[model samples]
Target: MSDLDSSTPLRSAVLHRDTHFIPKKAIGGKGSYIFLEDGTKFLDSTGGAAVSCLGHGHEGVQQAIKDQLDQISYCHSAFFGTNVTEELAQLLVDSTGGKLSKLFVVSSGSEAVEAALKLARQYFLELPAPQPDRTRFIARLPSYHGTTLGALGVGGHVMRRQPFEPLLAKNTSHVSPCYAYRGKKDGESDAEYVARLAAELDAEFQRVGPETVCAFIAEPVVGAALGCVPAVPGYFPAMKAVCKKYGALFILDEIMSGMGRCGTLHAWEQEDVVPDIQTIGKGLGGGYAPVSGILINDFIVETLDKGTGMFRHGQTYQGHPISCAAALAVQKVIKEESLLENVRNMGAYLEQQLRQHLGDHPYVGDIRGKGLFWGIEFVKDKTTKEPFDTKTRLSSLIQEKALQPEYAISLYGNPGTMDGVRGDHVILAPPYIVSKEEIDIIVDVTVKVLDEVFKGL
Candidate 1:
């Protein structure tokens, strides 16, 4: 490497997704908006990948973190326990209605996922009759778990996995995602489609040898990979049934769709089935702190307790006191303010606005999702439901336009919805604190962005 000279102008010291594509720095933010260093404000409709549930500048959360910092901020999980961490765990365990009775806190969603995977394997090994062969995992296609090695291996986003194919573990397999927009056959009823998907999952279990499979992982609502696609009625319970029959654990990755991001506190609450293991992040600390965790079902906790008497996995920063304190305050705000109810009421209003404005747009192929989480998938031909070519980068273009001076809005773009490389969509997940006026602004700006981008196409 050549030595750098002080005379030479330097590029961004921080590495972003594309080194050449340096984004403007956001200097300040308040509820539902972010202010760039240039003083341009953007309506934060996407909430930074749906993490800022409480939005920015909440005095209550800020105070909690400050209090935690004053008392104690760090502690090794293996050595000692903190009151904030204990309280947070109790709150989570109770939130699951005793179904998921244990909590394993981590620093991020990927770490939480890795913890869940390891816990599942350990659970099998600690069983009355050990199952060393139970090492395989089955997740859905076009699904995203996390960026870590094991999490990436279990994920099914083809484009993301291709470069790291040789490095990823080979024990994970994929099944079709429950994407009704394209996956449902013409003239198929909702019930028929759900049955077909459940059967396909059953077939995959058989093909992979049921006894060797440890768990089936999926997002209750497909997040970034499929642009917030929720399953049709009875789809989740049906899939859970197959896991039950095959003795495989049902692992729900709710990093994006859980913790009241959807209408319910847990996405599976609406699906009518509880998961054996669940990983959640993003909204957990409302972006105030880096925190994520795995919630273990009662039976799994019992199995490990009765056998190993210890969890074999841990992290130095697990259950960081400051993170737990921040999350505790965030959860308190949600419950005390009854934000879940707001999520439902506002979610309906947002959906109505999206339909009213974009429902008739020729390029808008599908609009689906629940609660505050919604997706608008674009297409080349509405009648054929054909996606734009990957090279067109339609979703990215719309995103770029939406952030321009005229629009001053932010949204989340996701490509590769049809397969792992051939579709485009954008997710709109405003903060739960969003008001009617904000929703109107989001819809109006979105319409302008879409029209400008596809004006000639």
Candidate 2:
């Protein structure tokens, strides 16, 4: 070990997550592309797992963060609420047509979910018709809420929840997800499918005794777990009706789909029903600052305002002023630029590019999604719609190949598509700022990588 004979180890000191192969360092980003340390540029198609809605290195967002730092950065919510946080809350509540009259900011999607669950429980305590027996929750199978204890307990992703089964809430149960692609029976019409799913939820509420079920939570457009799948028409209204009939809260987790990632300002806008409580993240701060929050409708907010007058749940970083500033600026830019229109127009273009490039691939089982989000599912038998085995690692392999410097296109969540274990699918939630040429490159790399991976398999 003398200086003259010194040698270097192959790796660095940072603890690397082993989810994929070693990730290269990204030097900087601008618009729809990011540059690596080796001077390799990638399309950044998935916007860093759908977190970067405004793309990278946005000047205005950076300015907002700096402005907050100039005045104050850290102030506990217990003492005072910052102006930045106050305005952001107003903006979010106003965006929901005043239906969501209240907002509670937190640090991440998981925290938001935890807060929402607690809020629902507290709402019951403040209810005009109090029902202390209401403790049960009904979430959908193959859905993900968050990684924290309560959120994880309510989440039904089989792969994620399997290890924690012993610790999850026994009061929580799972019904079927609105995955029409796989769940809908062959002969069932859309109306029948929606009705059948509603019936299942009704049966679940009855089994637990409707009075015992506190909430029915879901994602308006299912993300990661099911690969950008949207519910069929009339699904949300039907689900909302069931919740209302049983006096259960409807909590929509739009952590991945909200904040104009889709054509509308919210994914639920297209669903024809508003939720009692909604969780949103990822796109909230556009990856400029770590932030998320819960939106409570008039009914829930009014209940607490008159009774408890304070939320029982609290977090150390709740309503951090700096995070709120960044989010406030991000929302301003969206309105100023009219980005939702861009999402719709460009989304149509993206679908066209995907169909022209990958639509005919033999192993490609399905290509579906809306607005700026999409998913490509792989299968062993396209006709039978059977997924490739989880151990095969087909999706991850394709994702890895796409992320190579030569490929230069970063894909979004490479989720296990089958009950969270034995399926293959990759998400494409490119920034709304993506251009025509960038869209073509993303599709090209994906198609090329799939072909290469399938041949090897």
Candidate 3:
């Protein structure tokens, strides 16, 4: 067997990310590794954009899915409810300590975000004093919520939103994200930085008319657009205060950073704040099935209960039984094995090892993350924190090098870490079950690849 040659046209009809860059056919995967049809195995460090938290071919999750199929595979949520779906929703609510009183299960993160936006708008309309003018949303810059139009409109990722700008809704406005790495000024204390971001949010609310906003959305740890940059201490509470003062709902998009990815069942748990609405995906089902959901706090539930007595949004696959079963099984495995503790312990080791190996590298500007989710940003001049030119494709080169036969490793690379158009960073989010030995291998191989890429620079 040989790797798929790039010179040859791809034989399949699938619309790949890059038509010219044909990838090897993955024949199988098991335990944090995927096997190409060419008999090569690559350690999955980024877990397919942080989706495969339980890793590959989990026997328990497989069994759970099969068991669910035997009982019932396809039951539309609007027509009927399955035991598995109900149980999964209950588990999610219980995990949140009942602060989030209602759940709306969807098939994917994008769908969940869309539903959350709709729910937020509906909640305001349902109030006794109907806020017909509360039609706008406040989001953070350099953030990614999802791909759907509603989700994309609220997102601030420059490259992704460029082509679709005309079609996107004009109701969403962006504010500066609490990104301390580059956004914080010299000699500025963490508290000062937090205050600055809060003031910006407050200003945005006023600029858009506080009563005109339905909700404010952000990722607890800014993903993709700016890499895994967790806000400094007291950041969330400060932002939430702004949302509350404006009489707008606070929504957290945890699609990439929740469901124990950041060492807590909910990433916001560590931030010491409770969002009015929350959307979660990726790690929620550990790649076992397509599943995501929104958690609504009591305020929304109470308002809807008293007014419409129903949520206006519905989907054909609202709560797929098998998907719910798979997610439930994935969550159960995480709890029974106590993987959150492993994430915390290994996350510290990963940060230490990354800093130890790459801290002095001329191009390594910053390394930041929490739990197993981490990002290493590259700069042309570390002292000045100047990013490489977008035309250089530095992040792409590193990703390509890491996946070569010599390294046989996987990583997530993205451009526009500094803003929407000009920065580069690579993210590494290994499975929570990763061991210290595996962490060493990941770190060592990553350093080798980086060295090879920047050797002549």
Candidate 4:
């Protein structure tokens, strides 16, 4: 629409996620907006899948990366450790108040989840009285952990897992997610719903043999798969209780919901539970670098400390110095700028604005989320809560329309919100530095886009 004509054919050597539709190239950005190569400026509402907490170009993070490059760029985790890496790890551990005692850095959320799964299994083997039979993992249905084989194995997003079923691990089983919007029955209270979901988890543990389980993995605030669904009150504590009863580790995948995205340093903090293993990414490095990591509780670390004295896992870029430096600087900026406070204030305003603007739309089924992360689910009939047919691809259409020159906004949209196949929802996770005015723009644009899309249908 700007520099490149839409009718022009485009070709590239890089294998894209969607081969049929090549995305617009982003040339540069700064502070809550991205500039496309075609000279279009877009409001980054979803923060590039909720990764850019500090937004596009922050001088502090850039300087940190440059300073690290000036010193050392790469060092094998086994052979040598850098001061920046240690500082980043200590900063993360200290943020958790030492409850989660160790951090294992990696390159992405999927890698962090992959590490979590393996570490859960190894933790059992490292026990004084080993429980090698504890080889199974239990995750919740309609949840997403990551995309790699092992991470994909434990995730329950039906559509994502369908094609890779044969290759996925057979040991992982799925239980009911604490998704109250669809899962809660009529007349059921929050406590009742949580109890029911917890019981379902316990039953799954019994069915799979509790003694054979390695961990019960779930997202404190379910991401992508459920569109920013936060667990009902007492949900995590109840689930953690079941895990404790079965002597299985409790793992929280906070890849998209942690690092102050949900108005807390850790989502589990609000849930009144602390996971034995927690995988975090997205906001960890604020998209300044490709970085993610898992935090381990003292018990898990102590077990390995006394037994194997090693994690027995290695990656070529486990603790890249530049990545660590970038993340450290991002964290400091978030703290010094008091951005978490902005996340809370702006988040509340966002929720109010979303509900006020779209809550009563006939096709809009549910408006939900916490802090800066929110989602709007669409349905054919709000009264019956019936989803539109998958053939319509409503979410994709909304996302595509929002990216047009008129709207010029970016949103995270996905289908299968109900069962990973039938429902549609779009998420809005603006940068932590976003303001009420920016939130207004995001909501105003979202309203126009939704109105235009649904009106056509």
Candidate 5:
């Protein structure tokens, strides 16, 4: 009667909804491939939610982590700071164009976003009365930063925010995200689209009372939400100008799209702008360990350094020695081995292969991305641009069916990607270490699987 019999898979694993169960255990991994318990290999196309930049396991990463364990295992930041922590902080600051004014290491992207929001609020409170009048934040809808309550409050994701609506922050406002495929008008030029979005942002700042806005947040490459949706040309520079005019901070969430996934160390580098507060994760430690952080600009960092003399915001694992060490190793390998070049080369090959294979498919509505980060949006009618019904779960079908022994590739994302629901898409952000041959295989298997699934429909 309990439905909890020993025969049930849930009895041992405690299954959750939206879970993917690959029969074989992923016992080990190396350079863009994961090995199952039985030794069957699965190419990690999505990098386990777009995290692993350097791929499965690297000698430099493992050795750095092991070296850290030899010296120190755990130490509170308040009590003491290790040499490696200071070194890693310096490295991040120097690498990030010398504008990473202050560094605060956290365990995840959500944590970094939460910290940034709180810091922004604190920046206002630190000001004298009648100060900047910045108490509100403006973000774009169809975006995600983190799942914690505060970060969730500012996020524009429909599905994740639905359950906790009443508990989220009210001061956060949302504008339309820069999704060229869905948001762009059919006849409007890209310039016109950028101008329209910039005007909308200006209007929101005014409606919120220009002086009362804290920051405008967005993902530079638009990962996870709209599926690798980059802003139209001149979008970010215009948006940044608006924020500067209002004296509000610009926050860019690069958790899923940064760390060299987009052919640059920082996606903003290609956007021709910099954020006042930026968040990075996923590829930071290359999944060898959990690590994420907020890279603040000089103005904000100096404000905190001078205003309160302390950030007041921190985490127990803010600068965990081992996590930082792993990330340091990850960054070193990325630089020394020059993996960003691979991202560019492999990305082009991937694009070409996908176009050759799926470019003309009836249901493949759109294929767009940068570097190794790409997404495939499915439509019921390509001519009309109509999306599949949300109930059909078309994205999940292809992902699940792709798990057949002969064709195993990881798919990342969910429904509601179109207007928060009523559409489907899947993202593939293979490791920067991916190869041309592997890219071809991924495209072939993906095409075969899509054909297999849609044939019955």
Candidate 6:
């Protein structure tokens, strides 16, 4: 076996995502860069999957965590609530202008999604007439929610679901995502494309017996699975209308796109519709602590309050003190520093730079995103929009090359941008504090790496 092969067990005890290649150890980080154990500094262009919004080693967030630790670190959320947790929850709700009335905190994006699924189910059960029959969920294809079974079942990422197909819930169904670059027909207008997508969703509801579906979940700006593909205009409202027509709840999974990663604090803010249940994370705690949660609309909260008066979900670390404190501090810093504005300004510059430099490249098929989150889809034939064969492993090559000492940069690369097994794209989600100069550096290095990788093709 090759040294990089997992068949040859590594010295480390931790089972990594890829046992074949042990990743560099991050010893420390500050601002937009991370320092490896061997003293190499790499620019954090993708914020570790768009998690670190405020960059790293911020004193304000660290102090908040330390303060919470000094008072109390752990507490059973069921019996007692920390002041910090309450404040954080209130802050999140208030940010939504009281539209979403309640918050249920958790430790990660997966947990938040799991809670969303359960809460969505329970919301139906808590309704005036009750919907015990509403056991199914509808989500978009080429999407991801989380790794847990319930979240995974609702998610439509084919490769992720393949191994656990037998174990996944049979109640979940998937329809086409509003991926305009590919999904939109050649002669269709944006409005027509959205209408067609809405019709597809409406048909999916009918196929699944809409009455049996509890919710329709999607990312306002599709992340990870499809490489930051936002829906065409009017897409969300049309889909939400269909869900309303079916009496199903509309859920938005914003674990990667929200929390000001997409200019607005909530990605839905840019959309015309509001989700009944919205899951948020990543940028919430800015990588200072593990934190994620669900924001519930007033209707759902009131329904439950009038019925069971409980969500009937529990986690040991729900509303964790330190996590809440760290998240609270992160939000405060964003507000104090006006980082959202920076995200908008810097995002525009990044988009302009990327398009100006890489837009016309023969291999660049599509570049789409909003705010600071952007993606570049690579193609073997630009005219045909033909993606490189999966065997090429183009995304992996770009990621590997970008991380070399000469490049000293980090990027989020993924295969299967076209479907579950084809296409490649790389995401650029620099921290909100990233400067124009840093963006130029990112674009320059990105060009170099892509050129180097594609030249041999």
> Candidate 6 — which pairs collide?
none
TM-score of each: 0.97, 0.96, 0.98, 0.98, 0.95, 0.98
lDDT of 3 by residue, 278-312 (tens): 99999999999999999989989999999989999
Model 1 lDDT-worst window of ten? 1-10
What are the lDDT scores of the predictions, listed in order? 0.91, 0.86, 0.91, 0.91, 0.85, 0.91
How well does candidate 6 match the true structure in TM-score terms? 0.98
lDDT of 1 by residue, 1-457 (tens): 1122345454668766654456777888899988887678878899989999999989999999999999988988888999999899999889989889988999899999999999999999999999999999999999999999999999999888889999999999999999998899999999999999999999999998999999999998898999999999999999999999989999999999999999998999986599999999998999999999999999999998899799998888998999999999999999999999999999999999999999999999999999999999999899999999888888888887887867888779888888988999999999989999999999999998898899846
How well is each residue in 206-256 modelled by candidate 4, as lDDT tens digits?
998999999999988887998989988888889989999989999999999
Candidate 4, which segments miss by more than 4 Å at Cα?
1-10
Segments of candidate 5 deviating more than 4 angstroms: 1-9, 13-24, 128-133
Which whole-number lDDT from 0 to 100 does residue 310 have in model 5?
Answer: 81
Name the weakest run of 10 consecutive residues (lDDT summed) in model 6.
1-10
**What is the lDDT, from 0 to 100, of the residue 315 in candidate 1?**
87
lDDT of 5 by residue, 97-187 (tens): 6977677899999999998888887777765443556778899888888899988988898988999999998999999998988889989
Candidate 6, residues 1-457, lDDT tens digits: the string is 1125556558777787776767778889999999887778889999999999999889888988998899999989878988998899899999999999999999999999999989999988988898899999999888999999988889998888899999988988889999988988989999999888889989998998988999999999888898989888898999999999999999999999999999999999986478999999999998899999999999988998999899899999999999999999999999999999999999999999999999999999999999999999999899899999888999988998898878988779998889977999999999999998999999999999988988867
Candidate 1 ranges with C-alpha deviation above 4 Å:
1-10
Between candidates 1 and 2, the one scoring higher on lDDT is: 1
Task: Give the TM-score (vs. native) of candidate 5.
Answer: 0.95
Candidate 3 structure lDDT: 0.91
